[model samples]
Target: MTSMIQELTVSHNPFDMTPTMNYSNTTDSSFTNNSSTITNNQSYDGVDDFLLPWWQQTVFFLALIAILIIASGGNLIVIWIVLAHKRMRTVTNYFLVNLAIADFLISVLNMPFTFLFLLYQNWWFGTFFCKFSCFISPCTISVSVLTFMAIAIDRYMAILYPLRPRIPRRHVIAAIAVIWIISIALSLPNLIFFTTVEQSGVTLCTYTWSLDKDLAYNYLLLILNYIFPLLTLTITYSRVGIELWGSQAIGEETSVQHDRVKSKRKVVKMMIVVVIIFAVCWLPMHLYFLLSNHHPAVTKLDYIQQIYIVFFLMAMSNSMYNPIIYCWMNSRFREGFIRVFCWCPCRPCKKFRSKLRFRRTLFPTSVNAMSEKYSERNGSLMHTMTEYVDPDVNGPRRVSNNRNIVRKSDDYL
Candidate 1:
């Protein structure tokens, strides 16, 4: 039974938890019948013997610790900026908040366990966490990818139809909700399949599936989480780039229009870089899994374990990089980070408050200026319409009323 279980419980290479091994053909009936004893003996042989040297392990541990700190801290700042500031709550920023939430969860919940697993090469956190961490690893990644896709689509609509009404806040909320729902649904299979098994006395957490089922799941993850999102982002951003740079003026160019276009282009460029970075980071990990599963010989290479660690860490580092990118590309986010982090004296706060008051004071004057300009454009028509009216046509009172109405309109402006 133990031999059979070992043969049946091949690891699926999703999270890179399971070690690669070659099974030897055994015909001894005594070994087959008492396989449990052999397993126990192997377990007692010590799994820690495979661990890296002390200094190498320390370096790996420190790297993971740094990644955890940066990823969690950066993503928290992103969430805070979006939630605390009214100006930061635009549609794109809303999607960014969702992305940050996913990254935050991954940083806090997923990375530490993964670090331990990489260090120890065994499941030490027990069964519940074994299942949970496996499930959420894919879930958070799916959410991030879907959010990126949604942002790409949003940008496409905004650039392609500049005059169209903006997506309502409710709809944006609904879309975010849907992205999580889909992500959870996609991750349900992992929860069902992941289990802890003791082999050769060493406890391992891995997904146990029939060969066909494993292949199907891998292909599904590759398509849904990776390939499809990458293609959609690439196509959508390409169209957005063409639309942004292809046409000059559908009508007369104003300073406002030029500035708006420039701002949109800047934002689009930043998001494009974001999408590209995500793709580049995760692509190697996905390819590594694909190659390892299809051509098992690749896993036998001298540095395969080290290479796997590098690729896996690269993928995990995706969550850490986005906040840095945002601070680099967006001035508002930079200012928000500075305000949140910097300890400023009273003078700067006073200056900021005075600037706000000045803008408030100018608001009504700006509205009046717009109204007067609009009224001036139609002044000739208004005069023509009122010119032919006689004082006695209706009554002298009616002519007086018309003049009063005109006076009031001018006064309101």
Candidate 2:
């Protein structure tokens, strides 16, 4: 949001004039009241481009709404998948929960106000939210990228030093706290700069910082929020991938070793795909902000508002795609999503089994028969959900299902 946006307001209501284009592509940039000149009974050329052609508003309105639903909904499901299920909880997945929380917060707080502000060319949400949204958006963004770094590093450590102990739950919680603290500290400038401005009758919410400060901060965000984290993820994941994949041949490895390697590979692949999506989705917006801040006059070109709309959409849409990625790339997450949204049960649904067991328990004469039934049904449902610590080491816990399928530390991927 270090980008600056100022709209030139004219004092005229000429009949047959179309709605004015009051938007600037300066991120954290919107139709703002920063311009000094005001003309009476005069009109500006191409100033009415933002809100004209009613169909553009209709389409974009719907698109933003869709993004709101999917990003928030999918992230909520992802949170549930990790927290509500025992098997999904792991050292890396704790970071994922933080990531999902940050993304979900963006979907709720940023999307609606952004759309309304863009559509009306005014700050309709008021002063408190104006600053809060600006503050929270960058804060959450910082949290997500940092959490990505955490996940990558955790996976790297778990795979590279399989015998070493992993981070405990308490330490991971402390790390999440530290991530938030750092994010808020970085975002203080946004809170300071963001305010509601009054011009003519229009109200705008934006930062009014000096040009040098804005550019410095934008560049800082570029490095910290986008570039630095992108590099960190790439390097870490590349190394992790090498460690997981560069191993013994099929004929030489035992079944247990093979299964562990395969699980780690699947989880690593999913994370790599997620990081790539974040990079690709945010590139255009980052470039636009960089260019606009560097060359202020570029904001005044014909059709520039439309271009910003496209770039911003691409960036904001980043939140919505992650849930789909989780479902598509990982079977466990897919099962969780299905179990939640579709009301379909995971394989070996226990609802019927529990009912049958209760019925058998009601008849004392069938005690031996109940034991036989339980044996035939395999391990009890409790065993399916239980996670046991490996006697060999203190890394991630080993999980057993009804069929006694054992997964190493990386299965939470």
Candidate 3:
């Protein structure tokens, strides 16, 4: 949160990152080591004001820790799954890689720092980090939303005109570079203006911009990061939805065509779900800021801090969902996760082995054992036999000959 949150001292919205015009008591101590009482005004009760009950605080800490572990671990595996595998190097997966990178960066940097910033009511890290933290927050968010928009457009192009040549890997590389450039450009103001300011007796990391300027930039963020992307996705995905489900499959009802149509539907549905989640998670935060800004008196509500915590958690949580969603919806990703788990001796994925056993298509060394048991079982190929695993192809005993056909998605999805 920026110094705008500093206004929380006098019964204001403590979590508001928009900075307000203010004077400081201490000289610039951003780079220099100063032990002043550092706190972000996002908390009405400053650093010394740890008035919340222990139970209430415990829930918040636990939630933050959960987010840190899940976001980091999940996104790390997603990155590995895409980069480490050859067949997974598809157009959409590349965009997913960028999305995962942004989330990973946020998970590692934003979650812990923000949690500590709230709990201790102090900025333990130095001034450089103060600015870096604020900059990276918006930058990563922009990267995510922008990447989502790009996916929508790419899907629009690929589906609406299937025969058209898709963007090459090199151009996608350039597009990724451009996404970061725009994100950095949009967030550069935060890097420049947000610094640690010692106000009254407490130090806060904030921006010193006047009210109009600060709110104007915030409005930009709201539009570019939330509103515009939402509109774009709605339009593009609407057309994509029409193209995919609006018409029947172009062939006689057969297993192959049904599978192709189903795969296409699955990919579209997965992307739509991801877009929906992005909208749901960030909507509250944007609405909260708008509500507080328009009606300043709202901040005086007794449970306002509690309200902000929920919105903040939802926003922070946006970073962690992409990986789980990928593994849940995409077949290749699920297999890759299983592979990673198999390699690790500790077998962190053991807990979820039962869940993954059904859909995943795995190559086990115990094929002979499975073949021997195949005669005993009825239609079980993988789960009951415990040899070949692919949850998607749960149909009649998957004839081994058609295995390659199921793995490829670019053909239809």
Candidate 4:
């Protein structure tokens, strides 16, 4: 057996299998065989050697399926709530709608392929998916980060300068368009640099770049997607926290002012939690890539492949988390999600209608009582009284004597 193995090696290499063997003058056949042998050996190095047991594979599969369901369902709920309900269409929520769209695309387009790639260690999909996935997966993530940044800035402006006029709806739309454009442009290089290459008997979808260029690109992504956004969120939220919670005096603490402050603080806290969760979920994946690229020897370790899979799943879970955060932290979003999913049956609808009816019935009585009181006091009827009902929330506001003046509700804020 030893002699046969030696003969096979000699036939493949045609030279002594020593470090000192010079290959410049070797025949093409021998060089090809040697290269093929090395490639075949490397193909089984990482995932194959540490392949999980059947039960573990089953658990992993179930986990990925759960992620798929949660990511898709949760993000779709966010999108629907924002789009279907006028109450949810604030400037900040519009950015969130953009975020939901990005996460939805990631959940639908990227997660399944990623699961297959990790499980099989090869790209079974054709070249089209190879390039398409490479371009879109990162693009969605970039959009998410950019959208988060936009939300942070929007919050910063609203909290820091409450007196200034809010950003216009058109400007918010333009910002969203710019975010998508920038995200696509950032991912364009993936279409050029990524392709499917055959290794051993399997086709692997990967980047085709020089080592230096690959490293540079990876670092660029780390900075743009992770580090810079994290810093921006940290600083902006820190300032927002101070503004909301710090020693700002409220000289006249009316119920309306108190509710406004509480609402602002709640929003700030929810956004801060979102930023922290994003950083936590994504940090491991970025660190894994950085370490693998900078220290190739780590890839040869026994459990390195498993660690990489865990890191990837952690990163992908980010797509599922924001909707959960929204549900848990914001009552309005929670109510919206409940309404979207019909989780509460007819209770919310009945309550909403009852409130509207109550307000409608009460407003006219109050107005009539006030008019009678005014007539008794002033000996004249007030002809300019106007009752304004907020169409979105179905709440009746106070009647005013100002003509042609429309009152906007602050419920969205």
TM-score top scorer: 1
* lDDT tens digits by residue: candidate 1, 21-54: 2122344323221001112223222555446578
Number of colliding residue pairs in each model: 2, 5, 12, 0
Model 1 gets an lDDT of: 0.63
- Residue 262 lDDT, candidate 3, scale 0-100: 58
Query: How do the predictions measure up, each by TM-score?
Result: 0.77, 0.75, 0.76, 0.76
Q: Report lDDT (Cα) of residue 120, candidate 2.
A: 62
Model 4: how far residue 75 lies from native, Å? 0.7
C-alpha lDDT of all candidate models, in order: 0.63, 0.64, 0.65, 0.62
lDDT of 2 by residue, 1-413 (tens): 36344445320111001112233433433333322112213233333434647888788878888988899999999999888866567777788889989999877887677656655666777888888877777788899899889888888877776556778889999999999999999988877767777764667775677746655676787788888999888889888877776654433443334455566677778788888898898887666555554455555566654565666667778899889988897766776776665444544443322110102112223434323321101122222133332222212233323233445454345
Model 1 residue pairs with clashes: 43-200, 43-201
Best by lDDT: 3
Candidate 1 local lDDT, residue 141: 85
Which ten residues in a row are the worst by lDDT in model 3? 29-38
Per-prediction RMSD in angstroms?
Answer: 11.6, 10.6, 10.2, 10.2
